[model samples]
Target: MTIIAGVALLLAAVAFFLLPTAHLNTRSLVRVNGVARIVPPETKVAGLAELEGLQTGPGSMLDLTGDVTVLGAGAPAERTLSGRPLDPDGILPDGARIVVRHGDHVLEAIRRVTVQIPYETSVEGKGVIVSLVRPGVPGERELFKGVASGKQAAVFTTSAPQNAVIERTSSAASGLKLAALTFDDGPGKFTQGVLDALAAKHVPGTFFVLGSSAAGNKAMIEKIKAAGHEVENHSWDHPILTKLTTEQIMRQISRTEEVIGGSRYLRPPYGSYDAKVTAAAAALGHKLVLWTVDTRDWETPEVGAILANVKAQTKPGAIILMHDGGNNRSATVASIPVVIDWLFQQGYSLTTVAGLL
Candidate 1:
């Protein structure tokens, strides 16, 4: 064959050998760092990698502990994994998952999340699919060996959240030496219990509705407003304001304003807020109210825990933080009667945030 014809033949041969019969999904990103070498569904690798000895021959014996490469589509890029050449057959195309091991060193690339956890990562797609590969021993956080989409792989990292602690406002909200027992992220399935408790004690509080939650439970939001309580801005989505830009911060709060209407007041989620978030609220002519004391019922579910937090935190004019929504708020609701009776007996009147400020 002529040189040109020979090259064409070789190209055809490689194409026939490497092409996959399936279409690929190419969304999501892959990042690799740290001392641990692992492949996730969001990473990519070439067949010519100088690791696991797959660059030249398909017969290279892999350690198989971390090495999970299989024969698939696309040309393998030339590279090195530790110190061995990767085989062409050992290369994965887009959406392929592979794992490799070299001594104490283990590596893998999963290109997609087998299970997409519904956390506040991004507001895209319906949700994530959780995938289970090999079976594991009962009840262990199964190390997600990998996530694979259509064309890449990555070793997934469980991200730990870093939150800027919100500064406590020292002064209590004004008026009547009244303490506003504000419950945020509420009007959920259990909110009626909180309402009943509050009503029984003849105390009125505030409910800062999250637009997302209120969308599904509008009546609850309406009920709180109707029940002599204050409805304020807690954002459409309960995101940390410190994580958002100016416009996003406004959207977070304003979207809730739209749902709740121009009523008044704003509470940052997780008590997380700053000047920018406060600015967004101010530009819209809303008061940025920070909690003077955190009842932290979201973390500790016991009624005594909730009561301890309240007693330790409450004072004259204190704006107490409690929750009506976002996960199980039963314990918070339970503390209402005891706290109301105690506070009222102690001459602290229970009033809406609007009544106080």
Candidate 2:
């Protein structure tokens, strides 16, 4: 009996040594911030302190209320557990992803941008002879932009734009019995007839020729010049000067100047002009010339009506508008002689616009 009891006791001791304890059986495998770690069975809930010690390298204990410095900017740090906000003493789960992000801090700054200010024009005095009283100047303004870190800027304040002022003065009518004969859109087929009429009467006139037309009709331009008539700019293709930008206006005037070798006067198409056109013309040393009388010759009016329009509108220091080209100008070609004769008969001297001025 003693021998049997000894055997059973020995077997019981062996069995107790081989079986696992409750603490060892409850051990769990968990990931802390993507790292594998073994949590002891005694730690039912884990916090930042427990995770900090589990980290491979020595690091500061997680501070819930401290600022984090990132890329020269300081802001509060945010802690998360598995994509959700982590409480100061929250439970940590197995296979959880932990993330920490710094909140961006806002900063204020000023930004500057340049803006173009167009000039303004003020015309004074009367009559056809115009002179510049004051030249124009361009101005600028300041724009203040408010910006925040990692955000778009907003405009908070802007200075008013300063506009340049330009002034022009004109002379009163001279009251002398003198009228200026001006032709437009010319250097074409009917140009010779008009030139012959002016040459026969020994009178000087102004011919405002288009740059395109002048480039193609070089001989006609030469004839107009040789006949003692003034050759001026009528633009290239005759666009409304007011409708074009400043650069476009400059191109139109400068191209014409280059083609005709330059002129001091420009007659905008359809008698159109504005502050921008005036400034552009002045930049190239050209002056704007407009007519005091309209013959409406472009409408193909009757020769008698054309002559009558001339008779009524002709006055001292007047610029008479006519066209030698641009379509069906036979009536204008026929009225040339009669217009000159009546002007002479009415005791009006026929001369170029420059001469009248």
Candidate 3:
């Protein structure tokens, strides 16, 4: 072989041997909740605020904002970099990544720290119930191999009260596409505005009324019902249901039933419920109604953000969650027509929760 050809072969062998070490020097193995992943080397994040912003920004799915626990691999795990324990800033070591753990707060429902739910279903069928009594505590993310046991069990019907019939319809069965809009914690000062918006569009929705609010705002609740909308239960006062005993939960539910006269459905406050809460609600002759699309209107985000969220997430058979009470809901009121117009353009017929079912 020519000397140049021999030299070229020798150089190729040297490069092959160095490739693994070069890769190890530039990439990091990150394990989020024990699932292995990779991040670029030197992917340092400083301060909780920055970390949270990065996690929730466009195109990212991990959220580290709420009550988080951080753990660092190697020694000196207690080190602090940005006013909080541990650090995410600077180059991560080759083959090592920091772990961030936080309670996963689903927008539409309560989530168990240990359980995996495949889809939305009634509380009883899931079997695993999470109570408000034990709130989530942020911990360091650890390696976890989550196993989804199987599909949800079949619905077991019992003798619910005669009045406890939640309306459910099948658009597919009827050859129509339908959606539902639901307002929670209502009968507040802003409710009339919401009603006015819906009225302008000639649209009907479901209102999950709070018993405490209903007693004081009977006229508002009546107005909601009289306007061709459905009025259902959202507890007497909004409390985390899982935090209360069965008796307390019953009281919260039953008192609202008394004020509303009777309800075919119940919406647990904060979307927090477990088996016990569902059982208590079942005895009261009510079915649980949770939302599918959340506007996060309570945060009083920019009106455009509210409208954007609804526009982006609405789907057939979806229950769109908005609020009529608990804050300045003018933004929510503003979003109504925008959402309705877009949905109508998309050929979706808006209806109450019962209508969607």
Candidate 4:
């Protein structure tokens, strides 16, 4: 073999041997019950803030932040850059920060917490109930896990409540007199404007809020209600429902409703759903209402694109799709006037989804 060829082979062998042994001492810790709890490396962690300036060396420190619980939500527990847990196995909140030390680097992390759901049915025909309680110190925040065991053979906990239902809704309007407008994925900053626009036009519409967004903005949610628009359930995380289990589907409905807790009618995210997805919703007394018109405002940021999409698609009894949240909605908001004006010119009367059917 040529000398260069032999050298290449030698380097390849050296890299293969060295790569497997290379690993930074990465830590995964969270606040539980107001203390920093070091989540084992084996635990799955998808929710953590970027630890840009944290110290992670032998002498690093970590400070607990917020409510100081191990399982609560929001802001990482603050930690000084030190290698030691100030009070090991202590409680910490959802957003608490922690520090670890490795040489001169102080490693840091924040709790990436998601709400735990109760009593979800799996797609495979099984039941799951997540106990808000997890084994931890006194006053430790409750922990949430994605995959929960069916029921503890040793003991079972109480069940969650059924989702709220729309008791008596107005008729789905006769002859499509007024064009009822509907917006999904909202409660965003622009939501107020959309509300204002509809109010100006004397139009009543429906808002399908994603569950997670609802939790983040309660004031806006109340405003949507106060604005006289119907608030309805969107999915929990706005993921494509078909990929999730029946229980997950219910969680999408229940969790969204978990926040809104009332107001029936749900428009699926991305117009995404299946028959099974519907059954999961029916179990919660939610009716699946697919939009007859999709403005597709989510596609381009251009207002013209939004207007064209809506103008091309909207028809009578159409549950036209637009959004007020989930990324910038300037385009969607811009298109509203175009669609409404056109519909009005076309002699379509505006009404709310509840009013429509």
Candidate 5:
């Protein structure tokens, strides 16, 4: 009995010492996404969620533990982990390699933006008369784009652009020695006297008459035409064409054309024009006429100043501006004979606007 008890005590002492030594030598190694770590013996790791230093989300992971592989969670979406689908909560064994794969997914975001659309311009006409047909307007559009990876594409256009149209004349050639004497706001009290002055000089002139004036003085218009003068259109009320809308502009020009019958020219009041005005004139088959020499006769300047203006600015292909009837024109009528004689003495042959062109 004493020997048996002694043997049992020795066996207990050996077992205690051996157990501690074995426990100290044992170690657990785990590899996460190819990174290796040593863990305490008998350490329990419950799936990828329980793993330390792992970012867990709606994705996939691979568990290669002891010749067994498991692909866990999520498919091929944005930021998805690549592997066969498996249970993410399954326990992991020692010496296991856990591969977390972030697969591709479509990321979406919505934003509103304003984009500018530029207007285009086009030009027409080849005369010494330039006009703007249409002022171009810019356009706008909204787009919805889908981006995959790093590429972008246009979705659609919300508004289309409006283009501008311009009409212009080529530059006049030099040294032509041609001059056009033009009268505006005519068929008034002094119109006959002005015509008498031109007839005395045997010169041809262009008369831009108001529709209202021409309507009242139809006989005078025919008489002026008989005197070999060119009668053309001046606006009915003579408002600034640029300030008027397209419809108003058309009315102003068309009414004058209707009254004047066969006139082919339009001299906008105050020498002002815009795209709408020019387009309206062109649509009525009228060419715009502007002056090179402004006598400022409407201001009733001195006859000498008016003559000086004519002489100073007259050139080849010159269009001289004079007013016969807008206001009291005793000065204009008086200056007419003197101006015509001076031009003749300067070796200039006065002609109509059409003749000058």
Candidate 6:
């Protein structure tokens, strides 16, 4: 076969192998063989369904997520996700849910509606708040309360508000080709080595230092900051925040903040936190910072593996998780320069977690 024809056949084979499952209703991503697939959160739903008992036609108004915007029931339009145009008739991804009503009859089958609410306050609020359309339909405000007037607040229906907020924000990352390198449980013997590697690259990273560790390694902590790196909280003893009481959680964060002089960000140990934990962090005016590309360097994996893991998963606006503490991190130290070189070659700007935001 000619080279062009051979290449076309190979492309066709790859597409067939990677085709998504059809008929799966889970999480609204592009389906292939009934299995959920990853799609951008902003992708619009192809067709809007009428309420089960509503007399409205295909043009019936639909409330997508919590945004009071226009949704029409017409032929599908091609749209992009992660920079690629999705199938025109693609079903809505699972990032959001919708609801509609006709008179007293309500048609709501969507799950996890709370994903639509952005928590501007503590996630531990006694009552969750959500935005809803005043009237289920346009011009229907003449019938009842002024809900039809515009957007209004309602009680969110979900048991895990923290998870919903996390899901919502997960897809909200910017399209910038910048990534943040974060070192957790730091101020250790290998910290200086890691810092040296970073210095050679002229890149600054965020170090999630432990309170107890920082207390003993005060000079190292100071050095990290002195070298132009950001210091953040990683709890007092690296306990799981989800299992701790409110007071205990407060202490973990407060003690770290005290030792670090002060911190505006917290990285919960093991990346675990429930609503209560999130609220506690918020109450202290600290933003929760989680990683996107985990180097698994804490496990002290093979040095080559550490470099490979970072190079494979690094992406735009990605937060790369690594470690500068917890026993031998020589592998992590050695991997830094190579990873930084690869990132630079790939056109990524390395910065602190706060800078990525």
- Give the TM-score of each candidate: 0.51, 0.63, 0.53, 0.50, 0.59, 0.54
lDDT of 4 by residue, 1-357 (tens): 699999999999998777843133244466533456654343322222233333222332222221222222333344432334445334333345555324432223433333333323222221110111211111212332222221112222233323322222223553455446778887788798788778777778789888898899988888878877899987877899978987888888888887886756777776665555666776787776666566777778787877777678665566677888877887776767777788888888777777777
lDDT tens digits by residue: candidate 2, 1-357: 888999999998887788755434555565555667676544433344456533322123212222222343434456666777766555455455666554545344445555556556666644554335555555554444433322223333344433434343332344788888899998789898888888888989899999999999888888788878899999988999989998999999999888888898888899887667877888888888888888899874689988878877777777899999898788888888888898889888877877766
lDDT winner, 5 or 6: 5
Report lDDT (Cα) of residue 303, candidate 6.
Answer: 77
Tell me the deviation in Å of residue 90 in model 4: 83
Best by TM-score: 2
lDDT of 5: 0.73
Q: By descending TM-score, how would the candidates be arranged?
A: 2, 5, 6, 3, 1, 4
Superposition error at 156 for model 5 (Å):
11
> How far off is residue 234 in model 6, in Å?
0.4
Model 6 Cα displacement at 172 (Å)?
Answer: 7.5
* Candidate order by decreasing lDDT: 5, 2, 6, 3, 1, 4
What residue runs in model 2 are displaced by over 4 Å at the alpha carbon? 1-113, 129-132, 144-173
lDDT of 5 by residue, 1-357 (tens): 999999999998999877755366467677766788776665544434455645644434322111112234434532112343434554345666656655523233334445668777676764456666676777886654332122234545678888878776632532566677889997799899898988988889899999888889899898889999999888887899989987888888888778878678899988886566777787878777878889999874689999988889887777889988878888888898898888778777777887765
In candidate 1, position 107 carries an lDDT of 35
Name the lDDT value of residue 315 in candidate 4. 57
- Model 4 alpha-carbon miss at residue 264, Å: 1.6
Judge candidate 1 at residue 265 and give its lDDT.
69
lDDT of 6: 0.67
Q: List the residue pairs that clash in candidate 2.
A: none
Tell how far residue 263 is off in model 6, in angstroms: 0.7
**Tens-digit per-residue lDDT, 1-357, candidate 1:** 599999999998898779853334444232122123334333336522543433332222222244434442223333333335434445333333333433322234432344322222211221111111211122212133343323333334454333222223333344346687888876687789988998897788888778888878888878887888778878887888878887988777767777776656677777665545655666677666667668788899988988888789777777888888889888888898978877777788777776665
Candidate 3's residue-wise lDDT over 73-121, tens digit each? Answer: 1122233323345555554454443454443332211222333222222
Error of 6 at 333 (Å): 0.4
